[model samples]
Target: MPNLDLWTFALNCYAREGVETACLELQSQGADVCVLICAAWLEARGVARNQERMCVLEEVAAPWRHIVVEPLRELRQAWRSPAEQDEALRELRKTLKTLELQAERSLLERLQTASREWDESADANQWLSALAPKGSCRVALETLRNAAYQTQLELAGV
Candidate 1:
């Protein structure tokens, strides 16, 4: 019943050795971690790359990330320095950071459900072979793709 859907794929992929740190680094550089997760998931499912599909994914994720997740992340990061002197605030910020991650997971779930229709591509083997990672995280993104694809293939045999 629980095959490697987008959310599961994301959790497993993000848990891979370099994936979480790489994703965080990419996020800091303005990449949407949710979108990155979608990219990996779609790749795993053999969904063809569609610019319109990509745009839809971005549109769905950006507002929640901006309005909910980023603020929490900003507050958490800003509190890191202050946490050095205040143990209570440090604990609170830690809780807030965990909440932020939960929000991101919710967003990831939304992305997953939204893109399930993409199982059948409108086209096959288009010019676009990969999702572009913004900023300097290309290496990290490549790592994610390789790991995700490998994981998908591995699990497919199971």
Candidate 2:
């Protein structure tokens, strides 16, 4: 089973302006691949949150606070029966899924920003490249390329 501390800490990295070594360290520490994928999606989206976005994240993360992190923390501090631990683990998985969906809303917003903001000569890509791992930059480059292709298609009215 995956560790909550590891997952929570890994998720925290998403709050940063860009992906860093800390983010990769989380991956190295056996974080779930699906969570990492969602994190990458969020990173591509970049950080721009309006009131509506903030509310969405809030609503999404709120319920999980109690079920995912809080209970797990309590259990870690004061052990649980095996059956209870099983239940908690199951709950944690569900909580993570909920958080992922909530995060997707913000991610979609970020991707929208990237689509509107991407520039060939702009420093934004440079800034992201500087902060992100090479693999991440490669993926971002691919996304940018796809976005450019779509733009061309639109221009051609196809």
Candidate 3:
């Protein structure tokens, strides 16, 4: 559970080039960005993915994701054009986007706390596939996994 703060993992990963775009693409396909961040952390820490852990994640994150995080994300995305047109709206939109990211970080914290009992074993694809499913968000999952791997490698200085 050491170094498993979901927020830290996510911020580090999301800061990587192309990760934000990839995450947004996955979100468009109904993939839970919180779950994706959890998956990346699990993968990075060598956590095993299974039904029990999945259920834990879902229970912890589903409500917040559906009710809070997703709405903030949608609102942030919805502001993209309006923010561009109005100079004043730009700063407000930026603050909102920051809030959206913080909301996601809270969701990730919940996930990390709930998943503390699970075993750790690495395999990036399982969590992505489990969260997304075949043919639904496959491309996004693949894209995320590749990006996660590169980010992990880079962070490790390998």
Best by TM-score: 1
Which stretches of model 2 miss by more than 4 angstroms? Answer: 1-84, 121-128, 133-158
Worst 10 residues of 1 by lDDT: 125-134
Give the poorly placed runs of model 1, Cα more than 4 Å off.
Answer: 1-3, 120-135
Error of 3 at 23 (Å): 1.3
Q: Report the C-alpha lDDT of model 1 over 1-158, residue by residue, as the tens digit.
A: 12466766777778788888888787777777778777777765667776788788888898999999889998999999999999999899989988997998899888877776765454633211244443456677778777777777766675
Model 2 Cα RMSD, 1 decimal: 12.6
Name the lDDT of candidate 1: 0.75
How do the candidates rank by TM-score, highest first?
1, 3, 2
Q: Give each model's clash number.
A: 0, 0, 6
lDDT of 3 by residue, 1-158 (tens): 34546676677788877778888887777778888878877776667787877888888888998898878778878889998999888898889888887887788888888877667555523677777644565656767777666666665666
What TM-score, computed on C-alpha atoms, does each candidate reach? 0.85, 0.28, 0.81
2 or 3, which is superior by TM-score? 3
Question: How many pairs of residues in model 1 come into backbone collision?
Answer: 0
Task: For each candidate in the order shown, give its overall lDDT on alpha carbons.
Answer: 0.75, 0.39, 0.75
What does candidate 2's lDDT look like per residue over 1-158, in tens digits? 11112223334434343344444453344332223333233333333323443344345444554455445445543433443658876666556556654544444343334334322232223222333344553544344334333333333346
